[model samples]
Target: MPLLNGDEEISGVLRKYRNIAVVGISDKPDRDSYRVASYLREHGYSIIPVNPTLKEWNGIRAYPSLSSIPGDLKVEVVDIFRKPEAVTEVVREGLQLKPRVFWMQEGVVNREAADLAVQNGVDVVMDRCMMKEHRRLLGGK
Candidate 1:
């Protein structure tokens, strides 16, 4: 089943959460991950970078994995920028953080991963760009 919810629901999550963990975030400026994370950061959302290849992103410590994020750190959303096949592990590990939402960026979708997240009582959003949603739903930056 498709994991997308109504616009109102998505917007509600966006409005309520300020801390997001961007899994598979990249260091490249041109990458979607970088741009989206940057946009969210600029809009007052705390972006926690979760990329194994990077030691840090924009001066913030980049965790090698979701589980690598410090236990005390608060993550309200797990924004996935990984391939569909990689979503399972991210969702599994992200669950440990107890995030309120599991967001699969545009073009990234996995029914199994979405099901797993939904079954765990977490809101699941598939194939949507966080930057676009924030801009469209709540007005431009």
Candidate 2:
């Protein structure tokens, strides 16, 4: 079955996952990825920033790709901040990391990529704000 957008599922994901790989994260604090990553980290989630252009972001080591993340650090959720067209590549790379979920942030969705994730036994959440969902379902700021 494809990923469900039910509140229960969102809440479950938020409650269960602690490690998040934030793809396309930016150095700019004003960016959504930065804010979301910061919020998640502050809330106790281990945030691994993923961006090819930078070596670090928000003080966390930024990997050039999902495959580059050290083996010791397991990624539970792959939160994508990239455009829809770029999601497939990210999803393909994230699958190698074997994350529990492929999360396409607000305004980003690629049906093909989502289907690929589901086919690999990975849950997918597309076009949703991870931070907003966490705040609403997990009862945090």
Each prediction's TM-score against the native? 0.96, 0.97
Model 2 alpha-carbon miss at residue 77, Å: 0.4
lDDT of each prediction vs. the true structure? 0.92, 0.91
Backbone clash total, candidate 2:
0
Model 2, CA-based lDDT: 0.91
lDDT of 2 by residue, 59-100 (tens): 778999999998889999999999899999899988988899
CA RMSD of each candidate after superposition: 1.6, 0.9
Candidate 1 residue 52 C-alpha distance from true site, Å: 0.6
Model 1 scores a C-alpha lDDT of 0.92
Candidate 1 lDDT by residue in tens digits, 39-102: 9999999999999899999999999999989989999999999999999989998999999899
